[model samples]
Target chain A: MPLVDSVLAQYFEDALKRADAMAPDYALLWQSLQAATYGGKRLRPALVLSAYAGLGGPDPAEAAEVAAAFELLHTALVLHDDVIDRDFKRRGVPNLAGAYRSRAAGRGVPLEEAAHRGQSAAVIAGDLALTGAYRLVAASDLPGELRLRLLEELDAAVFASAGGEQLDVEFSLPGRRPSLQEVLQMSRLKTAVYSFEAPLRAGALLAGAAGREVEAVGTAGRYIGTAYQLVDDLLGMFGDEELTGKSNVGDLAEGKCTPLIAYARLCPEWQELAGLLGGTPSAAEVRRARNLLEECGARGYVEDLVECYAARARAVLAEAALPAALLAELDGLLERAVQRSR
Target chain B: MPLVDSVLAQYFEDALKRADAMAPDYALLWQSLQAATYGGKRLRPALVLSAYAGLGGPDPAEAAEVAAAFELLHTALVLHDDVIDRDFKRRGVPNLAGAYRSRAAGRGVPLEEAAHRGQSAAVIAGDLALTGAYRLVAASDLPGELRLRLLEELDAAVFASAGGEQLDVEFSLPGRRPSLQEVLQMSRLKTAVYSFEAPLRAGALLAGAAGREVEAVGTAGRYIGTAYQLVDDLLGMFGDEELTGKSNVGDLAEGKCTPLIAYARLCPEWQELAGLLGGTPSAAEVRRARNLLEECGARGYVEDLVECYAARARAVLAEAALPAALLAELDGLLERAVQRSR
Candidate 1:
């Protein structure tokens, strides 16, 4: 973990230096990106490093670069995700986009113009982070064949995520009606492969693990990652803002059709709550909608779904015949992943 | 050329097939991407192949893959560029984002929501193309070391372009008053490196050309690529829409401060034309602004600048002692690239 942190830090330092030579404005982007890299759970990097060390990878240093790559990839995706969702804040403060927007506003730009500038900055920032991630792997000291293999895996992860993201946008449109099954699939593809499956498998591959073991870890990852997203949905709706660093009403305002919403759609209270979401709902409206969802068992239903996937992940790990250390570590991670309030 | 075309076609065919399995809506995204790939002059790929073959690369097949990779990268950047600029059309037709917007409109979604969906789709589609470009190089039949080197170069190109894009966005903000020198720097960073230098150097590298030769071609590329963008600016203002596949008044509408605008700032007529830009100027206003720019010598100034850069490019190419065939091909490209009315 420390190795990955150092790699990421060094990477940003070099990037910042290069950007400084370009222009002050460009340098600001790198500075903002460095800030965005902080405060993350490092879940993906943890999976990469843990899998590698637990499976007897010879060099933590090599795996560190790969782990750091995953962290960069995560940052890239989150930046773009915010742009798509039109979110300007993360972790209870101004994100890269919001910061740029505020910068513009401070300079007397109109609010709308400032907002557009912020979003455009975000798009460029994300491109940097995304390509930077690949550069890390491509430029690392790893063996050529091994690096190529890892890149292929990374590509598949990104490809699936892009598809998943498009599907998410499609599902969010008013004219489309996505079933709960489709929602779950979107969640898996959008969150699971890159966050968990690819990192886990890459670590295993780097450790010279057998194909069967790599496949097993990837399968386990799919379940655990889906459960993690499900928990995130719960936190988005019910968790305290102080703990979650997100407004509980934000998802309701966006009318995000999470598993909770999907379940609520079939409930008797749907008519009452349906109009409150996917709009600029007030605090009172959000509260009423939450209450209706709870009364209709939607909240309970999503929680049950999380537990089900977590259990399945546990089952896969147990039967995968992984090293004792890795199995225990994964078990601990799974519990914390799904149980976290944020 | 046919080889590159086939590679791209196969790439899209496979991509579309995969998207089809995801969902109908997702598949539509791939369809849009395929359409977006059409009608390009394939300048980047041409540079790659020309450099490779002209330098005596053994296998055109392998270089074709790398060339195709450049095309994908171009498409990726274009998609993101449209999102940043909030443009829905490309080549005089609905682009990936516009197509999605139209789809939503057909389904009775509000115009605003549909536009948002379309933009989000472009973001996702760009991600796919960006990563897919890397995949092409990583998964190519080229030797591992060669592939890794190409990826590193590609990474540098993307990084520079990202920085350039941010700078462009920054300069467009009301508070920024960039000089002509600064504008030229942005143009070179945003357009020259990825579009010209990288491809030429990459092709030479693939062909195992000497470092000095690669460096020479890269220098040539910087000049030519910058000149190409200058021509694009001229087309954005003076060229007919039917010929250019873009609105002639778009640059004025966006208030983009190109080198011409930078020069115009010092002219007597600037005050008369300034307010007409960076706002939604009416057609008459656009005409008046155009007249003012021409009267102020900004248009002729940019044209002279293009000739200056193109001449420098020709000098470098002539002195580089490149193979006769590649040199002739590059000269022909430079002429068409800078002189095209479109």
Candidate 2:
């Protein structure tokens, strides 16, 4: 993971330099990207490294490039996601779009105009990062066959994520109410595949692991990733803002149909809870909605689901036939990921 | 060009099939993308095929794939450009985002929300096309080295386009008036490099042309591409709306700081023309602005500039010593490209 971080740092530094040479205005994009990507858990890269090592990959260098590529993919998706969600901030700070919007606002541009300018910049920034991920992989020293295979993996991740995002957006439309099963599938596709399955599988492939072994690791990743996202849904509701750097009620305000929300939709108290979800709920309204979720067992149900998936992940990893060191590393990463307060 | 069109058609058909297998909701994206790309000039592909043939390349199939990749790149950029410019239509038809917007509106979604959803989908659509360009090239049967070279060319195009888009956006901000030289550079970065220079160089490279030959083609492409964009600006302001499928006054309405505007900025009547821009001007106001541009000689000045660039392109092509067939083909393409009303 440390190696991956250094690789990413160097990669972005080179990009920033090239950007500055190209045009100073473009450098702001690189700068904003650097800031947005500063302190993620690096969970994807860790998964890549752990899987690569566990599967007996020869050199860390090749795996590092793949890891960095995933990080760029993550950044690219996050940038675009911000635009989709109309978010100007992430982790309690101004995002790339927010930075541009703030600058425009300071320059006396109208608020709507400023925001549009910012989002437009973010679109181009995402484009650069997305294609830059492929550029990095194409320029890497991997064998041609392996490079193509890895690129195919990347393509699958991108396609699935796009589908999931579209579903998420559509589900939020006025009259659409998806079932709990559909919600779970969307979350798995949106978060699990790219953040977990692809990175883990890529690492194993780099290690030249057998097909069976790769599939096994991906299965484990699927469980772990689902559990991770389910926990994220919980955190969005109840986590400490100081630690999570996100408003606990913001998801409710946005009317995001998380698994808990889906569970609530199936419950008797849903009529009252729905009233508090889609608008700017007062603090009292938020508290009452939280209590209703608890009273209706939606909160408990989602928590139990997370633990269930986590247990399944552990069971799969135990039987995966990975090396002892890697297995222990995976266990630690999984525990920290799903059990975290933030 | 025909081969490239067929290649693109088949590519989209296969992609649509895959999307259907993935999820029914995802199919609309592919459908919209296919429609958006259905009937372009296919200029980029022509350059690639021409260079490949003129340079004695053994296969048109390989060049077709490369040409199709460029078309995808063009579509991808146009998709994002629509989002940036807040345009729902292109060439008088609804774009990908517009298609999505229309669907949402038909479903009774609020206008603003529908527009947002449409733009978000366009962002994702652009992402797919941009990466799909690289994927197509990577999956081609060309030698790995050449494949890598082509991918690098694509990277260069994307980067330059992003920079150019940022500059264009920034230049449009209130109080920023750039010189004609700066406007030319922006237009070149936004259009010429990707549309002309890269494709020409790529074709020559695909044919195993010498380094000097590749560079020469790129040089000729730069001149021709600049001329083409200059002609496009003229069409935007003066061409028949029926023939061009765009409003002649739309550029003025948006206050796009084109080369013609830069020329007007240097003239005394600039103030009068400026007043008619950046807003929804009435027909009479638009007519007055056009007359002012003509009366101040900005229109004539831009026309002369176009001819100058066209002549430079001809001179460069003549001295490049390309094969007779390719030379003649390029000449024909250049004339049609620059002199067309549409």
In order of listing, the candidates' clash counts read 0, 0
Off by over 4 Å in 1: none
- lDDT (tens digit, per residue) of candidate 1 on B1-342: 899999988998888888788777778888888777775779899899889988999888879988988988999999999998899987677888898899888888889878888899998888888877877887777776787889977887888888888889888776578999999999998989999999999999999999889998999999999999999989888988887777888899888889889999989898887888876888899889889989999999999989999999999998989999988988998999887843
User: What overall lDDT, based on C-alpha atoms, would model 1 receive against the true structure?
Assistant: 0.87
**Per-prediction DockQ:** 0.71, 0.72
Cα error, candidate 1, residue B206 (Å)? 1.2
TM-score of chain B of 1: 0.95
In candidate 1, residue A59 scores what lDDT? 82
Q: Candidate 1, which CAPRI tier?
A: medium
Off by over 4 Å in 2: none
Give the local distance difference test score of model 2.
0.86
Q: Model 1 chain B — which ten-residue stretch has the worst lDDT?
A: B333-342
Predicted structure 2, TM vs. truth = 0.97
Please give the distance, in angstroms, between residue B204's alpha carbon in candidate 1 and its true position after superposition: 1.1
Clashing pairs in 2: none
TM match of model 1 to true structure: 0.96
Error of 1 at B128 (Å): 0.8
